[model samples]
Target: MQNFESLNLFAPLEKALRELNYQTPTPIQAKAIPPAIEGMDILGCASTGTGKTAAFAIPILDFLGNEKPRTRAYHPTVLILAPTRELVIQIADSFGDYGKHMKFRQTLVYGGIRQDSQVKSLKHGTDVLIATPGRLMDLMEQGKVKFDDIQIFVLDEADRMLDMGFLPALRKIVAKLPEDRQSMFFSATLSPTIRELAATFLFNPISVTVPSKALTADGVKQSVRYVQRDEKVNALHSYLSSDKVDRTIVFTRTKHGANNLVKKLERQGIVALAIHGNKSQGARQRALDAFRDNKIKTLVATDVAARGIDIEGVTHVVNFDMPVEPESYVHRVGRTGRAGAKGIAISYCTSAETKELKAIEKLIGFDLRVENPKFKFGESAPAAKGGKSASGKSQGSRRKNKSYKPHWQMKGRNKRRSKTASA
Candidate 1:
């Protein structure tokens, strides 16, 4: 459909869309919304930043806004289960924006904060509940939450929940919900495991898949740089200092690594922050708020922590550490290039990570353009053959025997030589 008006959404939701200046339905939104509004179970496969939040949110709001009052005390009519606290908050906020003109009530509950407020909100009851799996289960067991009144259930980021080993919890959550409810499952990629879970939960679901050239968003420009492991920080520093990088997210593999990188960047006079599993919810929210407000130029995060983040205007995404799972590369780069805005994804791959890079290429069905320190953009790196570079050097040999050094380190060495000569 060309516009929100064409979708026949509730007038209030249409008004909200007009106020927000939403002109067109994304591919996923276009296909998913129609079936969803018809009260059909929907299984949607679309990447992040494709307006997936609104794809499901808009229809759910419309359904609730028009339907008669079925809401019961301490029981929500609609339940949304996401994988992360950040995403739970994002989804709740989206509902709030779309349902502003309606009187339907919604509240988000997640871990890492005192549950007193959430408990109080639950005691009074709400029309909708957005929550992470763990917190939702905790409340369910304590009798503070119930799914008997739910008419609609949504599982957002199903692949991510599976990756985080929440399948068991999901099974428990699904078991608790009434079998006679509309179901919706959304994920960036659909693996066999995800399909199996969908089958177990959804009944005769209408499937919607928006296929792309690659798993990531079309607006993102992806590239990789082969550098020594120790030089990644320096490469990131250089990239952040460039004018092209405005509002960036640097993904690391570990919480400690993210914190350390933030410290190193701060030492260099860069205003950066880190948000990971280790940070308190308040701190993570603070960092996210600062990033959204443009008060911070860089936000370092781990893959799990970054999953639910939906900040806009991020021009660059730096993979300070390559993800072990190839699918994660798609998610990492997705942080940028959202909503038709151009985005750049730069990955720092060390010789040790050739295998990881190859796995990513195999999954994405294309080789990423390789850029060395001396070259802004170069030809695609030849695929590693049998854990060896195309040049017939073993991965270990490339890491240990290659004599090439980073330009910045060489420059420092040259400065030392000049100082000795002058002395």
Candidate 2:
């Protein structure tokens, strides 16, 4: 119930919040801003659209505004690291929005384009530098950026960072930071691994956990449709063709799958864009911008590409392929139903993916409502008639198919090979 004014933030920050029409503080913001402004380290567990960005950004801006720290060339006072370029860009944008009234210079450092501009920005001096690990490491090696003067450090989407195998780079970067700096670690889930990771960066940090409802797939109308593997594209196309879908993001398991799905949708007269790791930074940003502006209503992306992206008014999130990890299911479904808005998450599940679906169900602590949609573009009936069971065998097959593996696991094994293919 606390408001931004009650947090007693700097006058400039309070003015900016009011101009942005931000009145009451979210749970994470309410709990994190007070101590964060007091120069306390924070360990926060919150998901996208929970006002997590403001939780850290507000405090950092307030501190910078009040102290009026000297901006050093190649040495930013505040460092914020995210897992992907999209996330890094979004974080920088959040800082821009929240720090509008403050007198501070901020720059972004990420890969996929060129370092000349980023290098120039660094040389010009910056107060807040937001970057991704890979490009930041490259810059660090070339002595383009330094962390010697860092006053505040934030690692947003800590879980995603670890998932993308950025631990070594994170360790190297953390080693360069000043021990006297205020560290804030934010993650979607504070698993044992995350807790262990936070222990290394944070010093006597105050832990803030958002209510469980915000972390889970709450406020979303979730449903599962049983369909054969071949029917997935048509089923998805049918859904997209409907008038109800507005600003939908389709999740595919692989980069190739995302591309293929986009092609299929385009052939079906649907204008959709695909984004994955293989896409360049510019391409990803263009697609994200198009989606945000409603220039494109449908966007197909892999889990890795879509993580930590906060786009409002997403009406639907279609799971063209179920995520291999149960935790990813929560992240995928969370794309919609954000900021107290009602959303629909439709997951298409084949018999081979039943195990994955069950894992997701177990993680979410409830069953997804089964939906049986009548076929329109297709030539036949629902998947239930003459369909394989969870065992991935025909109805007449009595013998156990011991060689069966979940679709997601099968995809996992070929990930190394798939890496070489374009998204």
The per-prediction tally of clashing pairs is: 0, 0
Assess every candidate by TM-score.
Answer: 0.85, 0.87
**Candidate 1 local lDDT, 188-291, one digit each (tens):** 88889888889999999999988744447668889998875555676688889988678899999999999889988887678899998779899999999999
Which residue runs of candidate 1 sit more than 4 Å off their true CA positions?
Answer: 212-219, 373-423
- Give the TM-score (vs. native) of candidate 2: 0.87
Q: For residues 1-423, could you state the per-residue lDDT of candidate 2 as single tens digits?
A: 378878777887888889999998888988998999889999999877788998999989888888989987898999999889988878888888888877788889888998999989999899999999999999999998999999999999999999889999999999999999999999988889999999999999999998555555567999999886666777888899999888899999999989988987898899999999999988998999999999999999998899989898999999999888888888898899887788999999865677788889998889898897562222333345456643344644433467765445566654544343312
In order, the Cα lDDT scores of the candidates are 0.83, 0.86
Q: What is the Å distance of residue 31 in model 1 from its true position?
A: 1.0
Worst 10 residues of 2 by lDDT: 375-384
Supply candidate 2's per-residue lDDT for 58: 90
Which candidate leads the pack in lDDT?
2
- Candidate 1: minimum summed lDDT over ten consecutive residues — where? 375-384
